[model samples]
Target: MLVKDIMQDIGETKKKDTRFTNRLIPFHDVCSVSSGDIDNAIKSAGKEYLKDGSQAAGQKFMGVVKIRNNNTVNKESIINSIGDIFTKNHTVDLNDPDFTIIVEVFRNVCIVSVLTDYIKLRKFNIFGLFSGGFAEPKKSIHKDP
Candidate 1:
């Protein structure tokens, strides 16, 4: 619901003669979760993304999945499973895509999105993702005024 609200807000603010039929989306998770639920959640989210009419004409899209606080679901396995759901014509264009999907799997839920822009991705820091968990926070150098 929040994603839809945010999309509507962005569409209204952009003031562009554009349709949301094909635009990249970013996802945020806020649902209840349980063991072995990632697969279903992902499938459901993917369907929602498609139903939103966000997939571009060519089905050329990019994606990034984040898993936090999950211990059982393997990212590779999820990717493989999800990949199969797409049409055979689907292709991943990492460098430049008609749209991008961001999948965030948190402790209690999973979220999949088709982002409208890549701006939000600039803040994603790979250095923060560690083997066990997010990398420890580094000390800030700037002092509060």
Candidate 2:
């Protein structure tokens, strides 16, 4: 299913300087990567991420991230590489759980969310999480309220 499909409408309202409103879906709009453009974005970011001079984890994180907008991320090949990245090291969940990865999609752009979670986070201020999910809303997004 698409990310927008699961998002529950939270009604449109103004926040700060922008007229903001969300289709508030089950998943947190902080780690989503739209299938529409993420193919290319994944490729580009993955290359840079792999060359960041840090130890690669290689954990093959497979799933879809939720978000409010999809226009702030590079769409093309970032997601695909990140998914494959796990297979090389497999330490993604054990080490880099902070900066909760999320994606926001809005027609022409994909906004990746470097999320801050109150649980299961290993690193703080790591808001530059280079992670994102597909249109599918995993169980994590939808929780019983």
Candidate 3:
């Protein structure tokens, strides 16, 4: 995978050679849908990733990160809607979640996936990876819905 190779190169060389690429997000599903259908799209795409009963039994923390390229979509509403899809046993932990739900909206298209170690990966920003700056855990004011 190109992403894996780039990440491996970054780790091995510690050199900042990337340009033009901002973030590398691997998605499980993608669909062309209106803002109104975002919730259903995410639900369908993320069902398998969120349905792990064994992991939920341990009360894993989950966080949602929504990136909207257009002004038509409400970011908070999307995040909350995705949060509701997770099992009740999962708690909200924005700073250091066990899993992160990514909702990337570009006009009428939406890409959805669940990822682990999102924070540690510098939110998948290639530039951030070479900066040697780590994301310090922050206190979250976000409550579980």
Candidate 4:
């Protein structure tokens, strides 16, 4: 099965849970490619993402691209390569981004995908959740008067 199909299936399954509202889908076109072609693959994927954006001016938004290097290619080299591409051709925001692009590189091939619409996961405040910043609603028990 295609990676897209797998992602869609996972999204559908996750939607059954009430907590998950936004279904983050990875926009991918080509499935596999050589490790050396990472930059081209990302560029193609980014362009496709821009084309799909309905808003005029191709939807002005910020995002960061990451590479998960599981192959022989040095991780630093991958980071630098992706960083150069972004700096030279695209604008990215690290603090708050509308989306995230990830490239998972294996020995023979790599996968590129754009991710967005993480409403629930984004809103979660780890510090607050751990520090009791949110409280559960209390139920009142009534006694016969």
Candidate 5:
């Protein structure tokens, strides 16, 4: 251990932020949807969740209008892609929502659900997911001994 090692770096946790054993880290840059992708994602979110096979609505493709990136386990970027589906005029009342569509473009996986208020959720298939993620068989991951 060197003397410099003991010195703290910027944003390092201090005594105030600690909560028992877990040190409360000052919020760091999160992996949320980039500003550019927000508009289409939100809009896509709304339409995909609405009635089945609802093609992209005519709602103007306004870019991601709002960004509230925080520490959500599932990166907001993934959600934002679907979020882009919403229009500004569209009302999204979390309490009693019409529908909630989750589009994972990366894996070409879309989960659609008609909302019974935001709390209750059930899944249905909408558009065929076009995204794809890396696939590896367990055997391929490691060579047999």
Candidate 6:
């Protein structure tokens, strides 16, 4: 909600302003890394965004976006774990997914959410949207050599 309002305000401004904010990424839930909290948080968020009957069976494409600041957490492990939750029902489309599961691990906590327009919103970067820059090239989970 707050991000939406900020985007609207930026849109209303005639002049492009780049100093106020840099980015605004929203999350549905936050939890500590201990006691399987990360898994629980992602599970809860998945239920809300990837509800059954939302699309035809096996037709929904989902992707995972993970950013880890904590060295203790393995990025691939987290991404694969989250992917396990929806793999049975959806296909993986890193280039352009219908829904994206975001897992941000910072120190001892993790923030999780599902975003439908992550790519369309310039990956939720306020500055990118305001600057009218070219859309970023599609990203893949695997790094290309």
Which candidate comes out best when scored by TM-score?
Answer: 6
lDDT of 5 by residue, 72-122 (tens): 324555444444345333433333333333322222222222222112211
C-alpha local distance difference test of each model = 0.49, 0.34, 0.67, 0.46, 0.29, 0.69
The candidate maximizing lDDT is 6
Q: What is the lDDT of residue 139 in candidate 1?
A: 36
Which stretches of model 5 miss by more than 4 angstroms? 1-74, 103-145
Better of 1 and 4 by TM-score: 1
Give residue 54's error in model 5 in angstroms: 10
Residue pairs of candidate 1 with colliding backbone atoms: 24-114, 24-115, 24-116, 25-114, 25-115, 26-115
- Model 2 stretches astray by more than 4 angstroms: 1-36, 46-48, 58-64, 67-82, 92-99, 113-145
> What is the alpha-carbon lDDT of model 4 when measured against the actual structure?
0.46
Off by over 4 Å in 4: 1-35, 48-69, 118-145
lDDT for each residue of candidate 3 in 1-145, tens digit (9 for 90 to 100): 4664676577557776767787787886787656557767777765655566654443445655565567767777876776677755466676767677788877777887777666766777877777764455566566543
Clashes of each: 6, 49, 0, 0, 20, 0
lDDT of 4 at 89: 37
- Among all windows of 10 consecutive residues in model 6, the one with the lowest summed lDDT is 55-64
lDDT of 2 by residue, 32-140 (tens): 3445445444443344334544543332233234334345554334544455643453334422242234444655545543332312221211121112121222344
Candidate 1 has a TM-score of 0.50
